[model samples]
Target chain A: MNSAALPGFDDILAAAARIAPHAHATPVLRSRSIDAIAGCSLHFKAEPLQRAGAFKFRGACNAVWSLDAATAARGVVTHSSGNHGGALALAARTRSIPCHVVVPENAVAAKIAAIEAYGATVHRCAPTIAAREAACARVQVETGAELVHPYADPRVIAGQGTATLELLNVAGPLDAVVVPVGGGGLASGTAIAAHALAAECQVWGAEPSGAADTFESLRRGEHVTDFVPDTICDGLRGTLGAPGFALLRAHAVKVLTVDDADTVTAMRLLWQRMKLLVEPSSAIALAMVLGHRQRFAGKRVGVILSGGNVDLDALPW
Target chain B: MNSAALPGFDDILAAAARIAPHAHATPVLRSRSIDAIAGCSLHFKAEPLQRAGAFKFRGACNAVWSLDAATAARGVVTHSSGNHGGALALAARTRSIPCHVVVPENAVAAKIAAIEAYGATVHRCAPTIAAREAACARVQVETGAELVHPYADPRVIAGQGTATLELLNVAGPLDAVVVPVGGGGLASGTAIAAHALAAECQVWGAEPSGAADTFESLRRGEHVTDFVPDTICDGLRGTLGAPGFALLRAHAVKVLTVDDADTVTAMRLLWQRMKLLVEPSSAIALAMVLGHRQRFAGKRVGVILSGGNVDLDALPW
Candidate 1:
């Protein structure tokens, strides 16, 4: 993909402005105990407190609102079993457009209910990425709706970047910005915004060892599509999207993988020390810093707590 | 106890100034999902996100700062097994003075560790009010340190009131303000602040049914002093402090009691919907309001989430 096809800082700025009226500028929380444990000053961007209880709302809102009149009139469709579906449903609601989501048959019941609660039509797929995509494509063809591919879309990438943009603007001069990578929308956007706003700042992406496609992709210098994710971080189970993968490679964003146990430990620590209710996916960013203290020690690190949409009855701990 | 001895709105203003450089002016968090379920506009004053993970820091800071230079030079002493001890310990550290906390032997190890982590000298006593007080008095006499009673001191009362003062000032006029009544310090402070700030606003106190002294005290028109607390809300086990009770009575604060089950449910909902890690004691405030929605229905109610210090292994659920 050409650089022109990828999102830039201007797109991020526009996304920030476009979603301001809808999305929350979630707080930047600090914890002395957490900092002491990590041996670094960490500023946590709490996207768990965002509009749809996740930062996915940023990208979803940007995609839904960026649509031209006729395209928007036909509504939007996507395939997600997590925050993205709920976020897109909520975003489409703002524009009074219909949203169709292709979720897996084995998806968490609570998540499906949440997506439906946000007014999205749910189509159960056969618990495979290929099945989900096929179902989504069928919905798009039948309804003449636009497919808002979660992370791969330029608008969605720009929207995700706004979180890091807000964090850098408020926290000021962070030595590094770290984001949890799943499909890589957030990490790609974070890299673009961090580079554009804070030239000296380095961006790193943390992925689950159970779902280390992004880590493998970066190491092999190409997208790695084969992996059966077995992590506690449900949100970080997807394969890295091509556009996001390309953008991350181009920006030289380093990728690291943390074990599920470490992510759970990080989640508990965040809950205990920071008084934040974040999911394993959100906690992985902090886990990355703690696991590799030599790289982040004594530095000001900005961590994006991606989301907080866990089932309370089935907590990993 | 006389009205003149109680903290006034002016004292709250003074406390705010005294602790401005130390305490966090905690954010007012709102959730449409919570509001929809409760049938009210529930604005949460998130003190769980405050220093020492509770609102106790406000009172502790105010008391520490209000001391004369010579008195402050001698440090401070208190008897508490929970957030108060940790709060006072942190507060004393800010003033560069020693702090001695008399915690009971039966206190949770996590709570004790947290208090000690705040740099306080911990003296363990038998799990009895008399034993705890004796140890506190001993510490004060031996070290020439001032005793800052958790909820009874005028300065502490004024300091705790500042949470509600800031909330009223920022969240605008509320129809009612509800706070968890652990020993009645926060309730007393909240009542005084609400009455002074919004004369028409009703102030309500929530207590665990197992530790329902405050509810019974308000009902009997006297401070009830005997009962072994059996609730999961460890922070509310203390008998209602005399000064706090007198202030609550003077301000005509209504008191309500909630079962441990309801408190746990409220805590889970707050964690799930609001993305906050609050203790069961803090959740009781919202439980009281939700249990009696007829009173708060369609009204703007300010609910104070008092603290967030819980053992992950021993969650009520």
Candidate 2:
């Protein structure tokens, strides 16, 4: 696959079939109180309940499985200090393949423990992109492992699209689908699935205001990745991937930015009202829906809760 | 129905049909990590996802719907300060009937708000059982409403059993089923359903060590409700009802007592590992199983996560 090529809807379908045995067909949950507050019928695609407690599992599982047997036998390597690393590690375990994760030295011990718990080798480096990438490269060479880019890879993008495909298939006809934008894999893939399967269904991306590189890039009609993230959404601080940017732009996906305060409030509401313990990154989707009630009023909106991995001791509220 | 009479398996089946439209057939969730920890195949009946965020909704809905049109029209009244109050209120709203909740003066403000949010009339009284009963009686007399006792009512017991019924129907055959013993509605109902459907499956009750009235009652072969509850499980502080005791004793249900610390540990594990934010009251079931792993080893155990109604600001751990 070309480095900058975006995965198509057909690729998403293939990814869905490939990961059917591994990934969970997470339930779509509804909250009446949240609907009343937002003035819209919201169908929540509960990816928080996915394997590894995030939608990242879909993409990681697909990437791990898409490799040829020879390459798969050599194992897979990724650099992530968040859900994708654990997701990839778990995906590798499903196939009984060796996995290596390049983690930042400053990464939370709990997150590193979680990745290790999934039976992955954790290689820690200094807390910088250069250090992380070099660590990942070293691991690939050392173990003859295949390098699986977390979001930029086409296989991962197609896997991410599977969640939206399932959502559309189960949620009937939705007026719109909103997904949180981090490295843009989920948002772009969601756009592809929603456009191909339900053309009339508008696709929107929710990003944290403090880490709105994707939002800025779309606004400027170019790539923008110089901003420092100050948001509480740890999983959403990455710059938008090149392929993800291309797909999202081509699909004309709308981007909505929400403040961290609003995301925290939405997170609390999800916990208190919907009984869902989602992280700030996942809650940003709900924040977008609630903040833009006028635009979504009386419409059926599907919001993907991206993940539920949170440090319970350090809750935002 | 006699006040001390136990509900039969037939009543549970009828209740299942009666409340099918109102109550959710909650999903049975499984966690590989949790299963590995206990050395048992655990099927967690996710009642925390049930309507009103607890299995209480099942029984409450059944009770409201079981009433005759004229009696239901007069409405239903209950004295509760927790999930049952909110559940009854929501259940009554389903029937568009007037519901009165006699909440104690010291009830959590959030609990009161939850009940009021469901359109139930809140009547505050002193924090004594006598005062709560008096307030319920006043409401019953003033509005000619039917009194819906929290647990003692046969209709409610039958309704609570529907959760286990659905669990048994979907989870195949289980070696045992563990339920938290609160006012005993869930435990007694579970025993009735488990014995009738899977006669070989053992039924066990988990209770807070500080509120082990049910445990003591079973040990002494009589009712025991003199001790005050000191545990953090607010929902399990209630004394076991007469009907619940009679049913539990007749079914030979065994009770297991767990410390509050163990319940908190299990609660955190559920939230962190399984991504399920269950209350300590519900976590007690997992605590019971983990505490007695040898008894359940190599067996399929169904654990009911009773509810997810917790004060986020006041998590034990």
| Model 2 chain A worst lDDT run, 10 consecutive residues | A1-10
The residue pairs found clashing in candidate 1 are none
Cα lDDT of candidate 1 equals 0.91
Candidate 1 chain A, which ten residues in sequence have the lowest lDDT sum? A1-10
Instruction: List TM-score per model, in order.
Output: 0.97, 0.97
- The number of clashing residue pairs in each candidate reads 0, 0
Off by over 4 Å in 2: B2-4
Pairs with backbone N, CA or C atoms under 3 Å apart (clashes), candidate 2: none
Query: Over the stretch B1-317, how does candidate 2's per-residue lDDT look in tens digits?
Result: 44346789999999999998888888898888889898999999988889889999999999999888999999999999999999999999999999999999999999999999999999999999999999999998899999999998999999999999999999999999999998899998999999999899999999999999999999998899898999999999999999898999989999999999999989988988777779999999999999999999999999999999998888765
Best by TM-score: 2
lDDT of 1 by residue, A157-230 (tens): 99999999899888999999999999989999999999998788999999999999999999999789988999
lDDT of 2: 0.92
